[model samples]
Target: MKLLQIDSSITAPNSVSRVITAAVVERLRQTHPGLQVIERDIIGAALDHITPVNFPSSHPISALAGDAPEFAAGRATSDAILDEFLAADIVVIGAPMYNFGVPSQLKAWIDRVIVPGKTFSYGPEGVKGLIPGKRVIIAISRGNLYGSDQPTAALEHVETYLRSVFSFVGITNLQFIVAEGVQLGPDARQAALDKALQETSVLKAA
Candidate 1:
């Protein structure tokens, strides 16, 4: 089995999402012996944001017109990113909320993977996802409380956006292990981390 681990936390060693993702991966590894793990740190990679030149719609035109050097490089990076996601049986993402949304680096990675005709398609009835049966586990960290009962729940975009995106691409076997209110205080942070770690410990093997 292949597992693709994507970490986008800029905080690295101190990142709560990173910690949770690592624990989740470790737990999975313990259960699934010989699992091949592929790691991608978007912060370290510095993936470029999507642009007109690198967009899929322009790829054919660029090829016909002789792709610019920069465009060619960008296309290759995007293709490789997409290929990695496609090849993985399980995907684990470390997503730390930035301003209540996903990190820009993670968003850039999402842009590369949500390619039409590759991950999804439009049918006569409506839009349909092409990639199904892949397991996706997201480790989310937020400084503020954003549970459904919390006053700030309306502002929680990290999990909401990811759930929509993955579902759009036909991934139904998705799960999230969240650590929220980390900035409330040291005690709160520890409590949240402990809770999330416990959740990871019980995660079903990929």
Candidate 2:
């Protein structure tokens, strides 16, 4: 078994989502001692935006070689990310929801990994998923609780976006463990974390 862990938390040493992600990895490692684990800390090296200097680089038909300028270098980064996604049997991502969506770092990583023809293709049949049959788990942490019908719950674009993107790539098996209301209070925070851990166990069992 192979597992890819992606952590996007800007908080160091005290990220709730990171803790849960680690626990999930530990549990999986215990179950599958021979599993290969690959960890990518997105905060450490974020993706570059589609700037004027790098816009052409992202295109697959760009004229620049892989050894071209550094700032606009896209083929190597895109290939690395794509290879990691392709090699993983399971992908675990620690996503911290910021401002009702995912962090910029996570979004950038998504942009880098989600190549048009590589992950998906739009043909006469409409859209098709190229990378199928992979398990994905997103460990999400948020300062506010959302998802239910209530005034306190805000709209969540992060989870929805991730689901869409992953599904577009042909990964139908997806799970999310959320640690919500962390900034509400200690009790709320603990309760949310506990719920997330419990969900993790359920996922593992499944």
Candidate 3:
């Protein structure tokens, strides 16, 4: 079994999403004793943001063009990033809400991995997802309670945006362990984190 554990939080020790993701990865590792885990900290590594100027070949992978060292390096990095996502039997992402959305580092990584030809293909029928049935577990932390029933739910873009993006790529078996109201107070933070951790503990490892 292969597992991809990713943490995108700028704060390593002080991140609630990281705590939840750690618990989830530990639970999975306990269940799958032979699991091969690949860990990535986007913020820690400082992944280069994608730009039009440096974007790798848009053509098929077999037709990789350009001899420029920069383009070669960019294509290699993109391939590695996409390969990590494609090879994972299970994916766990620690997503902390930043200004009602995911952090820029996480978004940059997405820009590379979720490319048109890499993760999905377009046809006359419509956009068809290339990868499906991947078990994805998201650990999310937010300052306020913005659940579906909450008053501020309408303004929420973090989880909603993720759902849309992943669904577009045919990832349907998605589960989220959310620790909301984290900034409310000491008591609330503890309570929310404990609840989210409990959910992670009960997740099915298979």
Per-model root-mean-square deviation over C-alphas = 1.9, 2.7, 2.2
The total number of steric clashes, by the backbone 3 Å criterion, in model 1 comes to 0
The reply for model 2, stretches above 4 Å from the true place, is 50-74, 152-154
What C-alpha lDDT do the candidate models reach, one value each? 0.90, 0.80, 0.85
**Model 2 lDDT vs. the true structure?**
0.80
Q: Global CA lDDT of candidate 3, please?
A: 0.85
Write down the worst ten-residue block by lDDT for model 3: 53-62
The residue-by-residue lDDT of candidate 2 on 38-106, one tens digit each, is 999988877776433443344464434343567445656665777898789889999988888888888
Model 3: lDDT of residue 23: 96
Compared with the true structure, what per-residue lDDT tens digits does model 1 show for residues 49-117? Answer: 887666553234335545677677777777888889999999999999999899999999998888778
Q: In terms of lDDT, which candidate is strongest?
A: 1
- Could you tell which candidate, 1 or 3, scores higher by TM-score? 1
lDDT of 3 by residue, 1-206 (tens): 88999899988789999999999999998899999999999988867887653344553542444456557677677668888898998999999999999999999888776778767889999998888968889999999999999999987888999998888888988998999999999999999999999998888866
List TM-score per model, in order: 0.94, 0.88, 0.93
